[model samples]
Target: MIEHKDYCVPADTWAARVAGGDRRALARVISFLENDDPCGVAALKELYARTGRAHIVGITGPPGAGKSSLADKLIRELRGRGKTVGVVAVDPTSPFSGGAILGDRVRMQGWTGDSGVYIRSMGTRGSLGGLARAAYGTIQLLDAAGFDYVLVETVGVGQSEVDIVRVADTVVVVAVPGLGDDIQVSKAGITEIGDVFAVNKADLPGAERVATELEMMLDLGNHAAWRPPVVLTVAASGKGIPELVQAVGDHFAALVRADQLVKRRLAREKEALLLRLAERVRREILQSWSQEELARLWSDLAARRLDPYTLEERLYSVWKGAKEA
Candidate 1:
């Protein structure tokens, strides 16, 4: 396991600044993490003890589900209750700039000047799971920063979006009306992941039908402990947002009452640990291999003299030997 002392001492100041509500420091740390800097990891380690205070909420669904609109409304609702919010909007990577497309940032301009609200737009960076690769760590940073709520708005990609469940304390799967065939196609993939379902654009023609289908889907599953509530929301009009917020709060309360909160967080930590270990091993292996060795391995593979499976075995053996040493 990596320790705080492994890194230089400067990160201690970054961690303190982040915890003390320095948004600039938090932004810099997020950038460092996005760029894969070791300082970000060190600061995170230093601030790890201060995390878990914020409620991490994931807003995700297929494209055209109005997720960003709903997130904006939710932020407003939470902030009205005097709760500070941190929003991490996962936008599609711009091919030109290699940065966020900035669509969510544009929509969420209302909160830009509010000191209690900090919104960050993160490019998906070709990450397939609707979230940026650095989103989980960024959520922890926001938690450590003392935000009452950390809302993660995903890129609204299809089914593979289940990654949100691993990080969020509450997952709100947003569905909009008028996408009949698309909804049918996504049912098997996304219907099972929601703790709360939001049928946004409630004023649309098929809003009730979408809500009904969601209820039917929920009924098909065994949710004896807590059933996910379907809330009809017109995010643009702020209709039913309070109810949506209540549903999210109810789900969280249910988790706490059932003693599942800590268990879920523990599972998240385990996953993060495993991922970190794998990443470190991969980096170390790559660094240990000389350019000539790498080139020769690639040449051999291309020439059909070495198979990928054998190459994988060889790398594993090297890693095992290094571990023993």
Candidate 2:
């Protein structure tokens, strides 16, 4: 049903197809992106202008916190309200093949027949902070494809995995009962990033205790603009999911009412630009260093002739010189 002959290059054709709501084309481009292929990067560039529409919600928590189930419920809730959804579920990498070890695609298979929903599983690929390197690009592609919402389900590394804050319009920190150190986890930097705290598995005992702890901790911070509400949810049965969805909507509405949406987006854009620049510099430094040069530097370090700081300076100088050249 889709024509591909209009664009000359494969990237152009794929980009055009994606812009036209072709799911297959979008998946193909995302695959190319995950592999760091030039075509994928080119396609993203071509489709960049059409992005920045979808609301990106990030769900993250500790292992066994039911983040996936919460995401599933959120998708159903959103769809019930006539909104289209896209999901990027980040999982740990397979040591041998460097692919996603957890098959989120299989877990989210219920949506396979729904044209309005698209889900993709991504491996962290050794990137830290609970996300794949291609996550931002994948979100952009989904946004360009006209999805109403993009849910980024981070790897359940821990409460410290606040990287989702960098990409999500609303960062929902999922917590469950029986995590003995729930209060400590909240104090450990998650409270600062969370726009909504979801107490999933609310059916479990001590759920009220966990919510109270979160509320008490939030009271200490006294966030003026918007206070992150703690919503109780039993994601497995979809109980309290509607309230969680409403909490997310309220946060977005508050951001818009306060005229902070554009400000947050601007900050996100700046951070993304800086990250790309850093990656480019790192790539250039690695490419500029010859094997012998690297070996000599390692040899110098091993022989105690040079410190890591000095080697880093030398490498920076080389990168700078190459850029100038």
Candidate 3:
């Protein structure tokens, strides 16, 4: 078995190669990182200084919302504008194989030979949010690789998928016509996360109704920055793609004008820093405490010799000490 210590060194080496535009090296680094090897985290930290160059757009929606098709069309449109695009498709993990299905690749296969396009599929990997830690690290890798645009297509929405807003510069929430009831159920979270709303499959019967409902919701909400625009698109037929792209551009421009992009960047940095700190503290605490110590603490709690509040205080002190050391 490969030890974590052995893996960390090569992961940083691979990360350097990836930053130098070595595609095979990038792939290997990403794959290793996906497996949650400790080396992968080390590699990601090494590459962190090179990131934050790319414009990240997150595409999220309920299952069967044609999000993949919409993402494909968006990539094509972006490429047509002479931009290099990186796509990160987040898919559900296979319980049996411990790998992702990568179904989005089937829809985005046209870009296989395009040197300007780098496409990767990520597994949820038990991440509470639609994005895994590896996926976040991969996006940074692509951003550092100098991709002009990065598109993140998430593994549809659940309660946790709302976290996409924290990572994406522009978030496009796609929904189909027949899912109005479902939309209503999830509107609070989705509405707040989306910078732009897309009514995909516009050729369907209830597209207008969906659009109207979204518009009304936006109007009702007190969004001082910009009201999220609801655009209709027939993603399969490639209809309304141009308008959708335009809407995205307009939203990006609005963010820039309002100086929200700077705020967003700062917020993203803060989030990344906090996550890193939390992970480090958690790992150090786990490593420093022996099994006997853990058992003793638990036994004390069970016997009422230690109260929950006091135990929490003691744990905090231990964590602080570990962090300081």
Model 1, TM vs. native:
0.87
- In order of appearance, the predictions have TM-scores of 0.87, 0.89, 0.84
- Quote the positional error of residue 151 for candidate 1 in Å: 0.3
Estimate candidate 1's alpha-carbon lDDT, on a 0 to 1 scale: 0.80
Q: Write the per-residue lDDT of candidate 2 for residues 1-325, one digit (tens) a residue.
A: 1223323266678888999999989888887767666677788878888988999999888776888888888999999999999998765543212234566332665898999999887765544432444777899999999999999887553433336788889999998888796543554578887899998889999888889988988899978889999999998899999999999999999999989998998898788778777867787788897899888889999999999998899899978887788
Q: Which ten residues in a row have the lowest lDDT in candidate 1?
A: 91-100
Residue pair clashes in candidate 3: 8-39
Model 3, position 43: C-alpha lDDT score: 70
- The alpha-carbon RMSD values of the candidates against the true structure, listed in the order shown, are 3.3, 4.2, 3.8
Q: Per-residue lDDT tens digits of candidate 3, residues 14-106? A: 677878777887777677667766666677777878887788898988776888899889888888999988888776543211233565343
Best model per TM-score: 2
* Model 2 TM-score relative to the real fold: 0.89
Cα lDDT, model 1, residue 29? 85
Ranking by lDDT: 2, 1, 3
| Alpha-carbon local distance difference test for all models | 0.80, 0.81, 0.77
